[model samples]
Target: MILKSPFPAANRFVTIQATMNKTNPSKKQVVVIGGGVIGVCTAYFLSKKGAAVTLIEQSSIACAASGKAGGFLALDWCDGGALSSLARTSFNLHRSLAQELNGKEAYGYRPLNTLSLSVTESENPSRGRKQTLPDWIDGPVKSQRTIGTTETTAQVHPQLFTRKLVETAVAEYGVKVVIGKVKSVETGGGKVTAVVDGGGVIDGDAVVLALGPWSSKFTLLSSVINVHGVKAHSLVLEPRDKDAISAHALFLSYQQAHGGQPMDPEIYPRPTGEVYVCGMSSQEDIPDDPEQIEPNPDSIRVLKRVAGTVSSHLGEQSQVKAEQACFLPCTDDNVPVIGEIPGMKGCYVATGHSCWGILNGPATGAAMAELVMDGCSAIVDLTRFSPARFVKRRR
Candidate 1:
């Protein structure tokens, strides 16, 4: 078949022909920077769409916030908002990806029942104390347990899931992985021509900036996209008896003895083993690279106090094995910045997923594939996620 450019007089046809015949005009390339969950998944779907994809990460793939996340997937968590629609679509895609990848071995996808409990632990005394406790929590609870059971609630080992997707993209779809710090995007005629990295310039017909928290840095260099980071803290715990915690996940509310404040701590029980996870101390405008984001002693104290409230339910002997902190890319309105980068031809941005990046990555990947390959998304409408929306709204 003779490949023809849309414009008959266009030189793209001659360029394509020359590349096919003898000269290697760099294969119609799509360079994706950042190998976190969003970047990896975007590259995977793009590769499946038959693009020559090169995913570049400065550090190891999945080494950033993607690996450090708590990995909870909840459909109703974003109920009755713009996020609700996207979350529903993404949840379905996550299930599909799990099935295709056999996530049991890597991501550990499993349904879970979630419960919210208010315990009488001294750490969270603001909830008011009562003599009788709920039979469920070993600690006497002043309030009744609010049981939330839904098949839609699920969890995955974030790093493993990202690794599996990247592996599948490379081994099954022929995507290439490159390790380098990208310097800038070379552009002319309002379109990206190549991406310059430490190794050298990597030419591409199209480029995608999926750099998560680092998206803002690239925008300063090339106006492709903008992103900021939201800091989060979490801790992994190994229950003294692992099996002492029940099959269901728990969210415990307690009062802080230090300031007499009330807070809720989430408990995530691993499906495969005795490890449990808790946390999330959050702060706005972290203003730091994800690599530099780490748990501080203050955040650790907050996590431990919250963990103590939940652990009291498991008989007060639970212990924390490790604590971690990382920044998740977030936008002004907290929705992902997806679709074309305004004013940048042949460039796309898919970052700022915030806390739900893992849960929503599959759907974002699929939507990205549609936008890049077919010029539109057939599933959830992406008009809300357009990178141009913010620019237009400001104007």
Candidate 2:
């Protein structure tokens, strides 16, 4: 079942044209840099709003964290902070998109139950009886607590969802995807005129830098926004009897038998018959190239060992399908930097999402489109997330 387009052509064109006429601008040409979830979603929303969008990528679409991430979605997980509103808005958009994309089956979208587990030194079997756990989790589970219910939490196959958004934008609208590494942004008359890459210059009326951690590498942007990367390692495993595994996400705080520090590993059993486990963050320097990102052998070994202790099905090393690592973008304060830069007219940025990039991609895109066309976001209030905050502190 194919999902219907939420933004009909006639309505989109009318709405965008009406907004553009207010500024007396010609056709809206938007150039989005990066092909991760954030960039693709920005391009998708712009196209939905009847803007001419060109998405430029150094590598293939979703080739980094957007593809490798464990696509866990939570509505209230990020509450009690500045991110509360943004997280809530994005969670709702995800629910709507699941239906608009022909239901959860299409993109591996589904509600999940989440639990928190802690390991203990005591091997007494009575320790396991204090909390309820699925029969499949047959290891050193000392304590378990339900953290989220199905109504509040969900999951998606990150790569599939990212690719779908770009595909839909291309087929339904006329959005363009260009393959090239953006070298720099060309500015004139106090506004961005075009993006210069290896191939050639792609002109645009507006430019968005959404290059994840790689955004910092561009001197033009690094001088303005302070974004860095936190490297993480993960593994995808295929269980022998996938049906036996329950649809529950596990956040395990493990105590290694011979260890000093406790290792926290997360396990998510996907609808696609695969289990994803991730933990172990490193302060390693960000690579200049996305393809150069590599997983530490020790990290992988530790993860494999943790998986074996988590569940019987995941114990088989032969079931391991992929072992990988990627860098998640972060800011000094940990809040995302999303909005137009103060000095760089027509230049916008949407990165530093860290682990929540995939979960909040759609809302960020929608808000960005509104900011670009209507001069402010009509959906979510982005005053606190403006890139100007970083620029002001530097002065």
Candidate 3:
């Protein structure tokens, strides 16, 4: 298992070469920005490869969307393609890590069977909506049609999972973690030399921009790092009885109308004792910071209405415990960018996972470690996630 040191060791300092003047040659320094799930996991992988790594976070670790996400993880969510390969590999890794590093208990990892449901309102109410509902959705009174099933489908308490990963990265691997705001990347001849943060310049051999939604604005990092933010609202419902919901993670795409507004809501049940119900998916720029994004009232109402349809066993509207809004970082093509930035040596990007950041974090980290240490990954091909794809499109 990989881990990091709580304190920076004396040997952490590398000797600079005379000819290079300021560049360290004896030890490698890697600076990873953003302390979200992706950032922390990346730092963990790099540190395990013997690099003197420092992770910097703008706020408390995982305090943003990473802390509040519905931690649903699926092994076959991306079926029959490049993304499927990555997601499948990632799911396996998450399962192994959960068992090996005490991550399962720490993050509330549990296997679940997932079900997808949809309800249809008749185009003509007089025609009877029940008869109009698709045959695929209509089953004997007791069961719904099975779109798919995986006993390995799982979830983790994202907040605790992120914290534990960071702690493990620091306590066992000698990584230096700092709380600061990164102003910019200082580069010389298109190669990153240092990362400018609150304290001062942190000299490094490589700089990884894993800042989630915030990464979209730092275009100078690389023309390849084109990212956007998708704002979503989620509701946390408190079930009066803990066993009210089944052990399965149910994904419902039910039609809902709240205050005369119509919407489709998706629900994800977690092992952490919280049920996540969400709807609104909007492409909004969270300019200042992710934490500044607030849940829109309209979306909240829609989510509540949708939750009411599926959470009948959880309890009434008053049982709702919390409301949350978060931004998901995405690329134009709706796939994550995990490889190095085009034209910028020593610079890398790992954002753009959108809603799957938590699910893909470990796979991305392991791939990044292979790229940085062994020059390639054998577990999963990352060519599809390369930053160069975006650069070519711009041209």
Candidate 4:
């Protein structure tokens, strides 16, 4: 049976011969210790460079934060910080990958207009005057302000994008995938030699810890990096009036008429005719297994209540699709750790992206591949995001 892709046909094909030529004739074996966007992209880039890569995952690909994240891409949002150059480079890479993979239809890749809304008592602030909101947003909206334009803001179906990246690496470049929990990293001569798991030991010339929050679980890495999980809850609603909802993404600060703490909610209308809403976050303990994660009941209740009030069509019980939650990997400084770990030769780390993992996955992958094969990244400078930075801070 021919499996049909739910995404649109991407007729473009990426050329990896040029990149493969840059690497030395001696092929190196790489082990990527996660299956999220970052890990998949890294594996893809490495395979494109003619390296033998083994992508190991504890669960299915993109089944964690990568699959559940809101794939909002911004070119200038991280400007003025250490992530500016990284963000800019990644944003541009996203557009290129979209075209290369025919992601425009395959993964719902497209530009979007983002808006900021302020809720008020009056349902129609203009007293039924002309408003620019989509017909489906028949809520008590007082005002809407443009936050991001199509020029800088864009979106992608995170799960599909991630899955496609891994699939391409395997189908086109023969990248192997190992499904099992990594028990430990075996080392000798101060370099990582192999990854030990339940099934057996897989040898590698180099290893990367891209295990998201689970990176903290391994004694080998937890002693060095300060990475933790921040739980976020979200809901996907298949509204009955999908056409009435435009392509605008909304960041709303809703003030309850009864006077209480204002709730900040983010709403994204996907090209696949589904609406995603998320906001509440907490410093919850990271679970042992990704499958064991669950959304807080109170959080889901609040989201459903507010979502219904904001868009009546979304409130219909029949339209409710998925209620889920995931953990975002974070660091003490809030910047991602994406470089070779000091003292541990041939060992690298690339997690702690927090909320921008999906946005920066491709660039991180490209940069990591360069670093692993060419001794340095040809793209953004990763000095500020080095794993050694955390060690330096401790002193």
Candidate 5:
């Protein structure tokens, strides 16, 4: 478990709000647990909407999947599915946010020309047909096709983006950051309290459980629905000719020499002059702590091979920036479970976006704030993502 990244922490009641406890008697006090993008965004929007927000985390911000995962965004990738509206709404919101937050300079926000390609490591580069792929992609390319244009695709530095939201929320919106793990959510009378691991209790009018993959570890949530963690690996590489790597994002069907099974790896070139490659995934027991998570060496090695097979610039000449693993939260139904928890008024859970967490973070946060503060969300329809859908199945 690594405690640090190229990124970076907070304390309880750290912000100077109107009051030591509630901040403002006129505003709704909302406590959001988990400091991942989902939770941070929730806190951001809640505070932006005039709610007194307190965000609690066990470790540094973006230390888990939020920081480790590749930050790819698409407008219609979730089209024809339950996530279509949410994805679209979030896509648009990301654009507006980029303009408002100086996202290009703050968090590496930019539109991308995305592609899908097939590469065989053993195949001779000269034996293949002339590829119309980007020049930097000088490898054993077998086939290529344009999957996404700049109009419908974009990306961000996930860790940077998440951290930026938190910074804005704290500096401008009066959102408090608490550095502690939430033990449980308890409701007595009409108020809700978040019990922290160190005996700290945060009182709030409402509470959101954005525990990511750890949502399953909570009995109150696990009893209603399961949030399983899928361990995924990624590597950040700084190529020798960073300028040569375009802003194109690649979705590849990669095969090594004497192939066993073709691997589906994805690549994204960042504005920070580095490229990200990710692929190898498996399911294993999620550890009790995010800090306990570690990438499998074999998976890391295979990802390196895949990166080299995709482009020479990312081959031996490239420097590895990060080799890490994080667990993506996924549900059995394959749709994110949002909205309030049944029978527990003012208690909500938002998790299980899987790989789309970064793409969908803004809308999720906006929708959650609307739902929590206005009694329903106008940002996007939350009907399909309700946790009650599973509660009905449980019945």
Candidate 6:
């Protein structure tokens, strides 16, 4: 059987890596830029495939969206769309990765039930649990329905999950981690080099750019793909009765007492006994630095109010553990760009995952590994997600 690739010209590394793996003593070297879930996953899978990998990051691992976003995984939420196969593939991969990495202990991985409900804050909170809600959801909740179950919906502490992948990639596969702000890429002389702001260069047989929302900041990608950021805010609450919280993720349509527009916030309970509530997302200009991204006071206030209105345990009695925000990378066509850059052989790109980054990280990484090393991805078809489509639009 022969392998097929959408990136025909860019498969130079395929033969080089194959020849090197066969006769040359040294393994193929791959430089992966970005430290978010996508980049970390790519590096992890690349190293697993025997590539000598170096992961470059502008900040600490999982310090941005990967760290802050609600780690909600839905096997079918993205079904009936282009991401259906990818979501299903990654959901299973998460399960296997959990077993291999002891994810439950290391990253708070667990299956949970997901619900969609409507809540209208009243002057008085309900004292009794209704509609089979866990006793703690004392808010004026109604119209509750199960959207997902343990078999299909699950989660991981996103920050810990990304870090765990990095740790495993380093300890088990000898992948190196580099801290730097990548300024540009050099594709001259048959090698790809990542030039850092301070004049540091990391060269490799191939390179994968997973810059998340920062993809637009990189001229190489922005020249072809239109990647933008959506700023989203979230808050974490530590309820006094931790045990009262069950592994139930909630999708809420909330209307405050003085209602204007209904708000859609999501709630996820971590195994470590913290409840994370996130909403209030909008398209915004991304800051030059991730650390500089802070939550809007109004958005934070609204989310805090939503938490209290949803559950008394999460109301004034709960501890405000974290109030933060991050940007979700979106694309012009609302699909991820995940193939070799049209004309840059031995250089690839992966971004524009939007809100599905964490849910799809593992499979994305695995497919990228296969695409970079094996010349094709058996994990998922890359035809629909090829960057060439966007390039074609430009013609």
Candidate No. with top lDDT: 5
- For each of the candidates, the C-alpha root-mean-square deviation to the true structure, in angstroms, is 8.1, 6.6, 6.5, 6.3, 3.4, 7.3
TM-score of each: 0.83, 0.91, 0.83, 0.90, 0.95, 0.92
lDDT by residue for model 2 over 200-249, one digit each (tens)? 56666789899999977988879988889899999999999898899999
User: What lDDT score belongs to each candidate, Candidate 1 first?
Assistant: 0.69, 0.83, 0.70, 0.81, 0.87, 0.86
Q: Report the candidate with higher lDDT, 1 versus 4.
A: 4
Candidate 5: give its CA RMSD in angstroms: 3.4
Top-TM-score structure, candidate number: 5
Superposed model 3: Cα runs more than 4 Å off: 1-26, 120-143, 148-152, 189-191, 197-199, 257-262, 315-318
Worst 10 residues of 2 by lDDT: 12-21
Model 5, which residues run further than 4 Å from truth?
A: 1-20
Ranking by TM-score: 5, 6, 2, 4, 3, 1
Per-candidate clashes come to 6, 0, 9, 2, 0, 0
> Model 6, stretches more than 4 Å misplaced?
1-25, 123-129
Model 1 ranges off by over 4 Å:
1-28, 123-137, 140-147, 189-199, 220-226, 274-289, 312-319
Residues 1-395, candidate 6, lDDT per residue (tens digit)? 01112112222121111111122338888889898999999999998999988777776778789999899999999989999999999999999999999989999999999989888876455533365887777788887899999999999999999989998988888777766677898896778877776556667789999999999999998998889999999999999999999999999988878878888999998999999999999878999888799899999998988998888889899999999999999998899989898889999999999999999999999999999999899999988889999999999
Per-residue lDDT tens digits for candidate 3, residues 291-374, read: 576888888876775565444444363378878888888788889988877767778889889878898998898888778766
Error of 6 at 276 (Å): 0.4
